[model samples]
Structure formats: structure tokens, C-alpha cells
Target: MRCQPPSTFQVYIWLKSKQSCLLCDETTDATFPICTGCETDLPWLGDQCERCALPMPMAGLTCGQCLRHPPAFSEVVVPWRYDFPIDSLVTRFKHQGKWPMGRLLAELLGQSLHYRFAEGLPRPDCLLPVPLARKRLRQRGYNQAAMLARWLGTHVNIPTDERLLLRVLETPAQQGLDAKARKQNLRKAFALADGARIKDRHFAVVDDVLTTGATAHALARLLMDAGACRVDVYCLARTPKPED
Candidate 1:
């Protein structure tokens, strides 16, 4: 028997099922925007500090800084390093308002978190996006962290509270600043919204990247002081130390 050619409608459906990889522009399935090759090329974090997620030479080690002064957050969960294409993807999503990129990253992070939860990591009562300054919020027209949290919430079946944390002070941007400077800039920068329920609840703070741990430290400390039982940091990428 001879095979019959597909109809025009079948061809249209096949074309619609394909999508473009955001990084390499190669054809991909409609499910994930990035192709498998591009996704594998992403800088996946490996052998990092267990607490802060800083990349290290070996696994199961804590960075000296964390040992000296433990961060208020219990643990940092990140899937990738802030290198190459991950950084570019975050920049486009955060600065250029490319939401698809953010959603893709969030979906991957959610999968990682789900696996961790199955491995006995405590699920937080709520997810809180690190609050953005009003000026920056107005300029950007959206909070990337908030968007990430919302997408992750939907993926993992958790609740997100955008208003739970508030950025009360509009300080200079943290970019180009040293760790100390970033910490100083965030001093008195965040506060809980009015009547926020705090005591005895576990929380996860969501952000696009964990750079110097300054912002995460500040927010985690605030939540800890407010009587949060446990606070975890969840971000898409963790930057390696500059000195490394």
C-alpha cells in the first residue's frame, strides 16, 4: 500500500506545535520555549555551599562567610549560576519586560522546588517576592520577582503574597555595588505590610538572582525578627563570588 500525504490542516497543526528557542533560535516544541541543546548549555549550578548556594570546588561544604555569620534564611535554593545565557535571559525578562523568559525560568525553578519538597524540604506557608522600590517599579512597570513568585505559585500550588513585603526606602540600585554597599543600601529598605501575619509561619522569598546575598540577608533578617519560623530564599540563579 502507498502512504497518503497529509492534508493542509495537518501541516498547519504541525507548524503551530513548533516554537523557537529563546537563546539559539532553533525550532523547539511548544511546551518549552528553549530547545534541549540550549537548555543543556545553561550554566547549571554544581558543588555549591549548602546554605547560601555559592558555587564551590566540592559539594557538602559551607562557605566561610555563612559559618562566620549565618544568614537569617535557612537555605538558598537555586538551579543555575548567574553566568552567560542565564544572565542574559534574566536581563531581558527583568529589564526589557520579556515575560516569556521569566515564565520559562520560573517553571524550571518550580520543578526543582517540587523535587526538593518531595525530598523532605519543608513547604513554606507562603512565597514573598522581594519588594521593589516604587520609583523602580514605576519605571519598570512590573516587579520581576513578583511575577516569578506568582508563576511559581501556580506551578507548585503555593500561595504568593506580593503585598506581604514592602520596600519603604528608595535607595540607589544594587548593581555595581560591593557586598557591603549593597547591605548598606538595603538597610531600612524593607518592611512588612500593615497587619501582615508573621509569627510561626514559614516563608520563601523569591527573586530573579542571588548576587551578593545582601538583599536576601536583609529580607530574611526582617522575617526572622518578625518571628517567622523558617525563611528560605528561592531564586533562578546564584552568582559565584567575584574573587573565585
Candidate 2:
């Protein structure tokens, strides 16, 4: 006799048994690798800048910096603060080729986007992964932001166009740079890919993290110059500015 396929419950059990939480290494019933408890314990962004998503003391208002000199992007959405295990996970994913960790983070970010969309956050016409310079792509073997964008696109049903944005300059990494320096370093770093057409469309630039927002701003400016009507930013985590 021919064998039969397993029931849905049996398949669920099999998947649950095969998955373990990335943080605690405990087996989880959820489809994602992170357990519910560990997910809840991650450093979620609290009161933040309405425009830049920078962690702040107040919510539902734009920070002074944004009000003084607005970023090119109209809005920023990040689910986590740059802290603790989230930072460690981002490091492993970006520098160590730890793809599983990236997937976990992307899933969480997707969930945040889903809820935001339900709560009246505007969905973009397309998603653009912040492009990596060719040299950096070669060095890293893959672009972590592109990977996250693909995963998020699949989860959230948004179309992603990787070829629309190009990282034309191989500038030094943004780490250790102050906000002003970061902006200057990326001034002419991004460009539109040839034949790209985003006229009157809304798009979100996707990245693994938002630090000084320099890179995102550069890309957003490029997109706006390319005739995109609106540009938003989506990232896994946001780094708060240091106090003077």
C-alpha cells in the first residue's frame, strides 16, 4: 500500500520540535526560531522620534533635530533598540554570515510592520534594500540588508526591487563616526540604477540597523531625486544618539 501524508497537527509538531530559540536555545512552538519569552524580552523601542524613530523621552512627536532639519525620508520604523542580544545577533548576521540569526530578526521586524500597517501606517508601493557597495558586497559575500528585505517582503507581501538603488561609492564604514561626519561621508555615495523608474511611487528603504540615519538619508535623497513621491525607512533596530 502507498503511504499517506502526515496530518496538519503532525506537521506542526514536527516543525516545532525541529526549531529552537536563538536566544535561549529552548525549543519553541512558534514557526520562527525565537521563543515567545525571548522575543518579548528583546529591547523593544519605546517612546521615540516620530520622524526618525530615535529613542526619545516622548512619543508621537518629532525630535528637535528632525524638526530643525528634516531628513529626506518622511518616516522611520524600527522595532528594537540597539542593545544587548539584538546587537550581538546583528553583529553575527552582518559580519559572521549567520543567516539564521538574520532570519529571526527579519521575522520580528516583519511582525512589527504588519501591526503598523494594520494600525494605519502607510504601506509602500515597493521595498528597496539599502544597497551595499560592490566592494563591500564582495568582502561580506552577501548584503545583510538585502537578505532581510527579501525575507520581509515575502512575509509582508510587499514587492522588493533591489536593482532600483545602487551604492555607487565604497565609503568607509559608519562605525565610530559622529552624526555630522556620517552625513558628509555618504553625501554622494548613493545613486539610482540605470532605467530605474519610481515616479510618483512610495518606497521604503530597508536596512539591518539605523545608527545615525546617514545612510538611510542618503538613499532616501537619491530616491526622492529619482522622482519617488515618498520615501520611508525600515530597519531592525535604531541607535539612540549619545548625550553631550
Candidate 3:
């Protein structure tokens, strides 16, 4: 008699027992691919702006910009400051098609969110990924934000919706642009899909990184205008201010 193929559950169990660290490639007993040392060495976000997650000198203070001009999103929750290996991992996953890197990051992010929820953060009704422009989607072959949202949803048990929001305009890349220019570039750039029922719903917007937050602001404003009760931003990393 021939040996039978492994069941899906058996395959899952086998893979779990044979895991290797994605960073150092060492065999790791941890549930995720990262070894404890590598995880400890990541540039975790320290004190940050309560509203924007901007790296700050001290905790419990909102940045001046947020106090002066509040953003549409209520709060930002991020794990790392965009630097070194975290930035490298994100770039490889996003631009180089290293999907395992993305999966590792998403798993870590989901764990972080679970901690936050336990610490009194309300879970959102759903997750909405920032919509990618169709042109860029074709070039990259996938939307990294959408992929993150889906993986994170699976880990966290939150519903993920890739189609509720639409990118209406194909704006120039926001990279290297000042905050003002970025805001201008995103004006009229996003819209809610037809028949999308956003009224009185809380939502978390998922993305790989949060930089100037112009994109988050634009999307949050659109959702709020559609009557979303609250909006929060969740990302793997956050870029510090230019001078910081």
C-alpha cells in the first residue's frame, strides 16, 4: 500500500515544528519566524505622539502640529520606528516581492494590536486598506497594504474589506514631497465605493508604514465624511519627523 498524503492539519503541525527565523535563518522555537534576539533588537517605537505616533522625546504629550491642526484619524498605533532592519524588511517585502517578510511583519503587528486591545483600545468594526492606484498595482503585481490587512485580519479575527474604499485619482508618488505638497497631492484622491455603508462604523486603516500621514488624513477625512464614527491608523512602522 502507498503512504497517504499529509492532511492540511498535519502539514500545519509539521511546519510549526520545523520553523526557522526569517532574519537570522536559525531554527526558532517561537511561534513566529523571528528569534528573540532579533525581535529585541528591532527599533521599537519609544515615546511617541499620542495622535500621530511620531517619535518624541517623552511620552504622554501630543505633538504641536496635532494640537494646532488635528487630523481626521483619532489615533495611530505602530510598532517600530522606520529604521534599519525594519525599513529593510518592509522595502524587500513591498518592492522585492519577499512575501515571507511581509507575513512576519504582519504577524508581529497583529500581536501588538492584541496587546493594545487588551489595554483598553476598542477593536474596530473592520479594517480598510489604503487603496493603491491601478497603475501602481499593475506594476507591483499586488497591493502591500491590502495583503497586510488580509493577513492581519486572519490573525486578529477582524473583518478586512479591500473594496469599500477606492483610489479615484492616480496622483504622483508622495515620496520626497513636503507635508504641504503631499496634502495637495492627495486632495480628491480617495472616495468611498458606491453603496458602502460607513455610517456610524468604526474603522482601522491598515498600511505598511506611516510617514507624513497625508494619505491617512485623506482617507480618514473621506471616511468621516461618509459618517464613519471613528478612524484609527495601524501600521508596521512610522517615520520620524525630518528633523528628528
TM-score of each: 0.91, 0.91, 0.94
Which residue ranges in model 3 land beyond 4 Å of their true spot? 1-16
The ten-residue window of minimal lDDT in model 1 covers 6-15
Best by the lDDT measure: 3
Candidate 1 vs candidate 3, TM-score winner: 3
Model 1, 171: alpha-carbon shift in Å? Answer: 0.7
Model 3, TM vs. native: 0.94
Q: Report the lDDT tens digits of candidate 2 across residue range 123-231.
A: 9999999998898899999999899999999999999998888878789988999999999998888888788888999999999989888898888888888788999
For candidate 1, what is the lDDT? 0.93
> Per-residue lDDT for 1-244 in model 1, tens only?
7377655435333547788988888898847788988888889998999999999999999999999988999999999999998999999999999999999999989989999999999999999999989999999999999999999999999999999999999999999999989989999999998899999999999999999899999999999999999999999999988887
Looking at model 3, the pairs that clash are none
All models: lDDT? 0.93, 0.89, 0.94
Clashes of 2: 0
lDDT by residue (tens digit), candidate 3, 130-168: 999999999999999999999999999999999999999
